[model samples]
Each structure stands twice: as C-alpha cells, then as structure tokens.
Target: MEKGSNHTPKALEKMRQRKWSKATRAKMQGKSHSAETRAKMSASHSGKTLTPEHRENIRKALLGHKISPETRAKIGKAALGHTRRLGMKHTPETIAQISATKLQPENRAKARAKKLGSNNPAWQGGISREPYGWEWDEPLRESIRKYDGYKCRVCGVPQMECDVALNVHHINYAK
Candidate 1:
C-alpha cells in the first residue's frame, strides 16, 4: 500500500462490499474511547503510510466542503490543547503500554527476521566471519596498542582500567 499505486477495480469492489458486523457497528456508534484506548490507537497507527488513493479521496471529499462557523469554532477549540500537549512527557505506564507489543517474543522474532543478513543496514556481505590477515599477530596488536597509548582510540579508556589487555582493531575491518 504505497503512494502512486492503487487496488484494481475487482479488489476495490471487494473492499467496498466488505461489511462490518452488527456488534462492531453498534460498539463504535456514538461512543468515545477512554484516554488509554485513544493513546493505544494513536501509537498503533504512528508509523503507517497512507496510500496515494486515500490521500486523493480525502482531497476530493474536502474540495468543495464549506465549514459552518459553529463547526469551525468547535474545531479550533478542540485544537487549542494540541500545542500545549506537543512537548508533554508520557507517564511510565503509557510508555510501557506503547512498547508492550514490541517486547513480545513473536514481535521480537519478526523484527530479527526482518533485519537478518543482507536485509540489515550494517550488512557487509558476510565479511565479518572472514579470518584476519596473516600479519595480524599478538606482537603487532601490542605494538598498535602501545602506539595508541594503551587506551581505547574512540573512548580514551586506558588499558589498566580494563581487566584484559586492550584489543587492537583494523580501522577498515580488513582483518
């Protein structure tokens, strides 16, 4: 479901013909959800992209609509608190609820599957398992460490602070 692409006539007709259950319609009619439910609903839709057809339909629907003054005033009134809420911090419970689905084992497995191997952003064509170059000996590592002042080049943590000797890394990861 991307921009510039749309369903065929058959698919569109099928979607149009789909009917909601009476119970579902009754449940949704003239009813507003609690704040927690609203928050959860908002969180679920956060990263989804609307297709171009949906955008066009919305544009066409609003093209010639005239807003009555009373309706316009109500809309403006409702938006007044939106700016105030922009920088508000979420409570611990809210944060936990938003992240609950992400912490589930099935979701974790799906995320891992999505990012595996060549699909991953950091993928380097399986070079990580390659053996080091012949010249990569312990003496050379020690020399490099000594040359670097026996500290981590990135974090500046000295060798003595670590339980083990500092590890020397190849900058280009060629080794």
Candidate 2:
C-alpha cells in the first residue's frame, strides 16, 4: 500500500481485520519495487516531516503493542550468525591513538559533564537514592521469599540451585 493514503475509519478497520492466505503471502514475498517506482517513492518522502499531532497519533497507536513469541523467534533466527564488521580490528598504534584522544583533559571533562547530576538526561532528582519504607525490612523480605518457596518467581529456580542470590522484585513500582 502507498504511504499516508487517507481511508475511512471503517475501511482502515476492515483492512486491519483482513488476512491473506499463505499462497497470496508466498506470491508477494519476493516482489521488488521497479526502479521508477522506487524513485517515485523516494521523491514522495524526500522532505516530509511528521507533525506533532501525526507523531502523537502514531505513538498512541503503538503504545502497548507487543511482538508474539513466534514473530520474536523468527526475527532471532533471521539474525543468527550475522556478525557486523567481522574480522575487523584496530591495530595497536590505532588503539593507542584512540586511547590518547579519549584521555585528553577536555575530552575527559566533556564525558564527565554528560553524566554529572541533573546535567544527565536520565537524572531523577536523586529519587532512586531514597531509602525504602520501614515496612520493607529484612524480616519481611525473608518471609516473602519463604512464601514463594525460596524460588525465582519467573524461572521457578530454587535459591539453593542458583549460582547467584535470588531477589524478590515488586512487579508494580507505583510507590
């Protein structure tokens, strides 16, 4: 289908509900755009920028969408054995040059500044450093662990069987 074509809500809903048979899907699998068509498509989108309203609409549409496990597995299998820049390596001299550039005082200061306090994009005003409530004591934690039979809730692995310590996580972090 062509990009950004307008359709009625009913038509769009119908399209969403429509499913193609395997034969139809197989027939379309290896199709490629003609050079002229490709040029036209490129020209159509060359200078387009989505408006805030359009961007918000797209965000809302995709807000809670999830990939099915079958689709996830297909994506994983498709990417298997792919190595980006395979066999590429920096020479010792090139590594030294890179190290020297990064170690320069100005470069070090810039990197440090990016991660300092509220200057960091991810800073949350030290909220994460606040202590847990009084109800979240070690005894409460141990009781919860015992209630769960001392096993990982997600993987069902017993604490005794795991190489690392098990932790109880709050699924809903509303507080």
lDDT of each: 0.86, 0.84
Candidate 1 contains a number of clashing pairs equal to 0
* TM match of model 2 to true structure: 0.33
Summarize candidate 2's per-residue lDDT along 45-145 as a digit string, tens digits: 99999999999999999999999999999999999999887999999999999999999999999999888999888889866535666577779878878
**Prediction-by-prediction clash tally:** 0, 0
Clashing residue pairs for model 2? none
Query: For candidate 1, which ten residues in a row score worst on lDDT?
Result: 15-24
- Model 1 residue 27 distance off true place after TM-score fit, in angstroms: 2.3
Error of 2 at 167 (Å): 44
For all predictions, the C-alpha RMSD in Å is 13.6, 19.6
TM-score of each: 0.32, 0.33
Compared to the true structure, candidate 1 yields what TM-score? 0.32
How high is the lDDT of residue 128 in model 1? 69
Over the full model, what C-alpha lDDT does candidate 1 score relative to the true structure? 0.86
